[model samples]
Target: MTSPTVSVKRVSECFVKPQHDHSQDAKQPIYLTPFDLPFLNLNYSQKGLLFAKPPPSENQHFSITTFLNNLRNSLSATLTHFYPLAARLATRKQQNPPSYVIYIDPENSPGVKFIHATVDVSVSDILTSTYVPSVVHSFFDLNGAICHDGHTLPLLSIQVTELTDGIFIGGSVNHVLADGTSFWLFMSSWSQIFKSNVNENACFVSRTPIFKRWVLEQHDPITSLPFSYPDEFIERYERPQHLKERFFHFTTASVSKLKTKANTECNTEKISSLQAVSALLWRCVTRARHQPLNSETICKLVVSNRGRANPPMSEDYFGNPIGSVSATTTVEELMAHGLGCAALRIHEAVRSHDDKAVKTQVARWYRNPVVYKMSGLLPPNITHIGSSPRFDMYGCEFGLGKAVAARSGMMNKGDGKVTMYPGREGGGSMDVEVCLLPEYMMDLECDEEFISALIEE
Candidate 1:
């Protein structure tokens, strides 16, 4: 396939603050919790959506200027209710080490970065590509930023890119402020305000967000990171060795089949769709890698601590309530026993990661205060899962049109790093975004069993 002429250039950029009077409590500082601290080592969470515009006859009020004005106005109105997003972070030296604290100050004011750009490429050019084009990465702001860098950068930045016949909306959020759940919540609220066009008095999100931050029992509020310097976390930003990122769409029926097969093979445990798909992927990737039978392989899944914690945080609690669980075994044990065995291992790890387990991990983090180095931490033969298929990704409509596809930023990239989203067609469907080494991705593509299980998109 020969390449075509493609170019991307920034058109405009500005800061958007809350529409209401935010000067009342402009200097309030919200301390991060144990649930949020480890994310210091990670990059800002960047996610985007692409939407097609209806014909001019269909939407007589539409224009390049009108579209930008609508989005800018709606985002400002939406920020009134979520004012924390417009704030910034500043470093606080606690004891000898440095700590981060988020606050909206009268001196610095409050605002979120909004960037508008145009690309000559069409939407089809993006969706039809074998892997996510590296250009999709530029559709967002804060290219290689770490969450800890929020002190010098905007706490949140949104980029709205105009495509040839469509539009791309991408955003980057400091993971310390909002996890995947909260990010979508903000997006949906912004969309709702844009569509309603009604009197906005704040409060439009489906669920009311609980802004009160969580603190581990007996932990100090102004806790400092164990690192000697903030740059220690930045060192982890080495580009993940993987060069290929593929989006695998698993139809609703195919997911059901995978789930059924896993449960049938393992009568003792009724595995879920996630566990089932993970099992299939783990086996396929391990087999494709052709690692020695005695080699060790690990499958890690990031679970929401919002529900699994001791008392369980509210679904509306708007901070990072995340924990992880991993299944470790030799390649021989995984492949010889089949999908059922692999799934059960994952299921059991997820099931056993109860409140006690969650607390234990938090406690350990508090003790050592070690942040995850992106390219290091996990083993080479590993599958690390993030995000979820339950998020209302497609519901984010901004009046111009609903979304047709989704893409993420340069963050969280590496071999076997996967993010899951509900399919655009709905009905319990799932889309798995996989990043892998070129050769391994080729092998996985050629794996007949893996390819046969997928639904042709």
Candidate 2:
């Protein structure tokens, strides 16, 4: 089969003034800041490169104007359906981060060229044995992937295949621009606009712009002590390559099964599926590493507060949700005691860093950018749960059929990295994809029983 050629050209008149609402009083509202702006807002980035495969047809080169028009319509339409905050982001610009999506010319290139443009697939009997790629991995890749650029365009790009079917689309977004949710909204909106269905009152509406420094100045009790970082942790942060990563997954049913088994064995009230799976994962990761852990051996879990906060931010908020770290241990003592005890520890860790703590943390960062900077420089061993949007919005209608594969790659962090998200087909359960070091995987592979637990029953 002839490879598909994907080329993008920037339309000169592509610029449009961002839409905004002027009804609110002009008096500076809450001193505008990045926090005020949706989180997916772009930041100037280091340069990188992008290349796509040649089109499958002989004369199927996509025109710059046509592609841009199509993209605008798709962006507009996508924003209308899933996230209304996109319009606000389009209008919100500070020192004007040099962030602009560009056109790539994948005229006649290597086979790898098209691979870069295409999505990934799941490795199940449904996809592999049948020679059909499942859309599950594609959504994961689109939502979690990042781009590296080093040319004139200089901006990361996330391309939806069409103006209507948001699935079967693939693109790389820059991490610095926004967190996962924020990035999704921007991409979705871009697709909606390309489709010419932009919502008039989307959530991307820019509130008064507030800089980070000013936000810190407004708060009383702003002088909180800096989050102390241990010297060893600081060293590890400086060496990105030194860290190890592994990817593993568990289905919703498998998790429930374990939860039931653990609950029955412990004779306790029901434990959350999340808690049960977390304890299992924590233990597995630690054992895989052949490391002896203790209560202080922490595993940080990232959960979105989209639907869990007191005054839940609008789905259109487009910024980091107000939340904090839920942590636990893989100590032999804890694991040996009983599943319920371990579940309780994990539960408390999550509850401990509630909304108030999260809000306070965000505020402190504004007041002390240095502290946030340091923490980011050295993030904990994070295990993101129920945060992967792979299957949640898989039926995205950017005009294309469902995606072929979805897998995320930007989470290059921590000793044992894992992200839990919904499985494809909303398959009545969730799937956790683990990315860790090869040595760790080898260790895990050595234990057949441990490895078997990860497979969906």
Candidate 3:
């Protein structure tokens, strides 16, 4: 077997001081500290070794340090972006540092640490492609371990090769901090930041998060942790072996029609487009399990608590929003019901619940530590939708070439798989990219009639 090239080394570790919020300004958003917060512990990792090439350079070479320096400066200016809750689970002192390595001892680690190159593709051809095939290949595996917690950072490497355009940009991120939408937003910003001409066209500076924990508590004063016992609902299923990715496109017209139907069924004025899709996906996942359709068979739904928590956080912070909503329903409840019924139930469960419930539940979980035990209560199929960074219009222009297509990479956490919701053009509809078991998706795909029904006419 051929040996690999490329190596990573940790240069230094710094003692980061903790920053506490003492601001009593009622106008300023109260932000929770990710460092000291409980319920932030989760493990995210995946490995996929694929092949691709970097962008081409006719007369000039791409500078790696320049890009890194730009990224640093961007972080410095947007300190909240780097230290935001969604991006970093831990606070200042607890924050994880991005790993930086060089090819000092490539021959030592062999293929395990270094990428095994096999393919005769030229460098220029690779870079010139609408999207760098190399970067696309890198997205398949999540190298989240490079960060302190499970936060993500852009990974890049440049070295002169006999083959001219040989380069790679890759890294892994935790699923918690940012969904695919957040990832793209950060990437696009990072690219602009690298160029040193950060145009206002490429940044999302929100005044506050959409959902907060405190707001949620006020709505759902009575809340319970979604899990009952570790073995009760979690240990029954086997983990999936093969992971596959597929895209599902829904028309705006179809979603609008569903929205009307959902709103009517729920006896409400409005129903979110995502709530409608969630209903369909919930049923499909349940069917994959071959479980009898019933409300008793529970599945968990996650909702972002960005502005839902106490004191309402500033939308300007870029890290992670406290995620605090979990909804459970049986396969039967979803299967036997129409989209409206499902939407109403899902909406009620999420909307009625608030941050106090999340805070209370978080407090309980910390006392008992439910993540390790309750992962199984989590459905074998998980879905997250309605957040895409591209809408912010941050152009992802690195010196090489802009990203042609960027979506969340495959996420293999516990027993369940994940599906990401991203914005699609047109005022009325949304797009979804599902990261599920190959077998599960195949089963859905084979059912042509069922799949067709899912599409809006």
Best by TM-score: 1
Candidate 2 off by > 4 Å = 1-69, 76-156, 159-177, 186-249, 265-270, 293-295, 305-309, 359-386, 389-391
**Residue by residue across 35-66, what tens digits does model 2's lDDT show?**
42222222221111111222347225645345
- Against the true structure, what is each candidate's TM-score? 0.94, 0.59, 0.59
Global lDDT of each candidate: 0.81, 0.41, 0.41
Residue ranges of candidate 3 with Cα displaced over 4 Å: 1-41, 44-137, 140-171, 174-185, 195-239, 366-402, 412-416, 424-428, 448-450, 453-456
* Residues 365-400 of candidate 3: C-alpha lDDT, one tens digit per residue: 444533332243345544433343124422544554
TM-score of 1: 0.94
TM-score of 2: 0.59
Q: Which residue segments of model 1 deviate by more than 4 Å?
A: 1-5, 23-27, 96-107, 198-203, 455-457
On lDDT, the leading prediction is 1
Clashes of 2: 81
